[model samples]
Target chain A: MHLSTSIWVWIAAFFTLAIFSFLYKDNPFYRFAESVFVGSSAAFAFLNLWFFDVKPKLWDPIAKGNILYVIIPLILSILMLTRFIPKIKWLSRWAIAFTVGMGAGLGITGMIQGYLVPQLKGTFLPLWVPGNLATTVNNWLLVFGTIFTITYFYFSKPIKGKFGVAAKIGIIFIMVAFGASFGYTIMARVSLLIGRVYFLLHTWLGMV
Target chain B: MKREIPLLITFIAGFLIVVALFIPHPPFNKIEETFNSWYIIVAGFTFILGIDSLILHNWEKIRRRSEGWPFALTVILSFFITLIWGIVSGVRTGHIFSTNSTFRNYFYLYIYVPLQATMFAILSFFIASAAYRAFRARTLNATLLLLTASIVMLGRVPLGNVALIPVISIAVLMLLWVLVDELKYVTSPTQRLIYIGIAVVAVVAAFPITKFLYHNLSPVTDWIMNVPQMAAKRGLFIGLALGGIAVSLRIILGIEQSYMS
Candidate 1:
């Protein structure tokens, strides 16, 4: 008989069982599978970088006589590789410096506009309109929530009195949001479990 | 000096990029882009480090004659084999590599695809075990947990009520209440005042609070992601990014040489 789709699926079902065997206890099978995964990923990542990202972005350009463009990067790349050398590990410092410098620069720039300012702007929507009752309530609640949450994180200052109480309530709102998120994640994971079980029963055992 | 210089560059470059965003100039944007390309180039070298570490780690284990020596040997073997295959498949030189080779396809299909699927499949039993523990009806909180779990569980299946009746009813009731009271009020006259204020501020800042702002999803789904849900996510990402920067800086500057040792 020709190997049909179902037969291919059966092959997958066998491997799935092999991997899932770890849940019972670690064994040679699990180790074998885990080794396969780690080995494959390492190989994949290394090859993908050279073939997809590096060769085009650097090596190809250099080969085409964009030699000047290649100089700084080639120097940096060599410095980075110096970490592998025993006596000259310190030479890698210059390369590391450039990378860390650039990353921090990018992050700080992105955070203010992408995160901080927008979030702060989002908090103070105009609740003073002519026709919106729920909008008014939501605006007020959000405003209160923002003020309180800000204070909750700002530990440098002491909280006291009425505002302090509002901040405390704000903390509760944050916690409830976190709990809800946790519940949502659990649901997602459990759904995946159900999917696997369904596959095992219907496809492997042909019990469905 | 090495550590200090890098930290200084980081501080300056970070400040410059932030300033560049507000500058509305082309050159600053170009510089930022250039810096970004360099960052990508630097990131490529990290793979070399990974391969080196993998080789050294497995080599040490094998030299020590560890229990999993054969496994380590297999990994080293695969590493070199792929390295060789990828080098040979360098036909498209100026772009991301593609292979028309049957060997590459077979490797991906037989090796990579199953490993990924199997990895996902393994989570099933772990989830079942976790659910069995987490869904216990010991207290009020546990009851709520059980309720939500059952509802979500039943919602997926054909006979949902049979699988998760109690939770589904609670979920339906909660959804109905929100739709009727909160949603209705949100559209009413008093809430109109709030929307005008939000609109004006959002427009002025050039950041509209349009329903489904970032993630192109259904309105209901978008609302869930944008509102309170985004807070923890933003915080988590910031924390992770900052931590990575700090660790990386220390390593690069040679202040944190633990990895090397």
Candidate 2:
């Protein structure tokens, strides 16, 4: 294995090991690395906010002799920071209201169009398929599972009677789903662990 | 005036988007894109508020020398250093992400990526520890969850047969242990015999079950995922959509005034 001679690679290796130290216990090295990560991420966000959004949308238009077009948003942006001043903090609400409105609008439309429509359509599978026993079974399971799961989540009445049975089955489906997700997450983490280990042995130590 | 004006803005904004969806003409068609641009630009400024909060909180900790103040100082230093580096790099190279920039290569690629990745990667051990604690096989529900998770995990990996054997052995052992544990609750000789008989059967069937699973684990896992798992997930997605729409409708109609606060 060829070791990386780059200083940046060394720095990366150090941080990787530092983070891994947490597996032993919470130590100063881990704490330092965690703090650094938090700080770097914050800095990264600040940089990105400037370069991607503020600069391009607000600054560029003004820079290119179109200040009037973006003036409202610029003013709104400034108004957002008025929260630092307690008396004028109410001014920030206008900016927030706009975002909230957009979010609500997106949520409504996104739900109806993106999820509800497609999911309902997919659940409308043919209950029977000639000589395709596996698919037929799966289709029934899918249709019933969706029904049960939805019923489990939605109810104003007490969870009893015939609905209770369906809801119980829904909870089982939910449990199975959660279990599958947990396993999948563990699999991902294991993959990442392998990657880090490979880096440590191959890149850092040249002992693959 | 403060609350009412904000509510009006929210209603108008939401109304504009909904209107744009139905009427796709000149001003109406372009409204969504224009509004999104304005939102993003304004939203960018909100990051400053967040950064200010983080810095102030950390600064307070540092000033008080509260617990891990040195680490707080480290956070502050790292933040400024990275921020200044990016800004200076952007000034010099016309972009912070330009090729050959230290901010891109040194800080971002090396420092940020590794830190984030390793932090997440360490969750492997934690997840394992958590699974061990939670998955006691004490109840049927817990057993079902544990078995589903184990199979899914095992099927995803190679040389799984080599590892599957030990896992199956552990499962067999656990089965026997549970049976023995049940003996404690036996009210009569019949109950004891029933537990013993089950234990014997489990021991006898362990080999065939293990062999079957070793051969068909992947397909079984696929079936579990494609059928029951997919069905459940689909249900969840539908539920989430309906819930989101309800909440959004509430917010848009001014019934939910939490955002105003």
Best by TM-score: 2
Winning candidate number (DockQ): 2
Q: Estimate TM-scores for all models.
A: 0.71, 0.91
True contacts kept of each: 0.36, 0.80
lDDT of 1 by residue, A1-208 (tens): 2333555566666556767888889887777767766776787777777776677888889889997976777777788889888698877766776676665556655665676667667765886756988667657656665556555664456677876786676565465445456556666765666676776677657677
The per-prediction tally of clashing pairs is: 20, 0
Scored against the native two-chain complex, candidate 1 gets a DockQ of 0.30
Candidate 2, residue A19: Cα displacement in angstroms equals 2.4
Candidate 2 per-residue lDDT over residues A1-208, each given as its tens digit? 6778988899999999999998888899999999999988889887988888877887888999999999889888888889788899999999989888988887777777777888799889999999999889888899999899888887766789999999989888888888898789888888888888888898788896
How accurate locally is residue B244 in candidate 2, as Cα lDDT from 0 to 100?
85
- As a whole number from 0 to 100, the lDDT of residue B225 in candidate 2 is 92
lDDT of each: 0.61, 0.86
Please give the TM-score of chain B in predicted model 1: 0.60
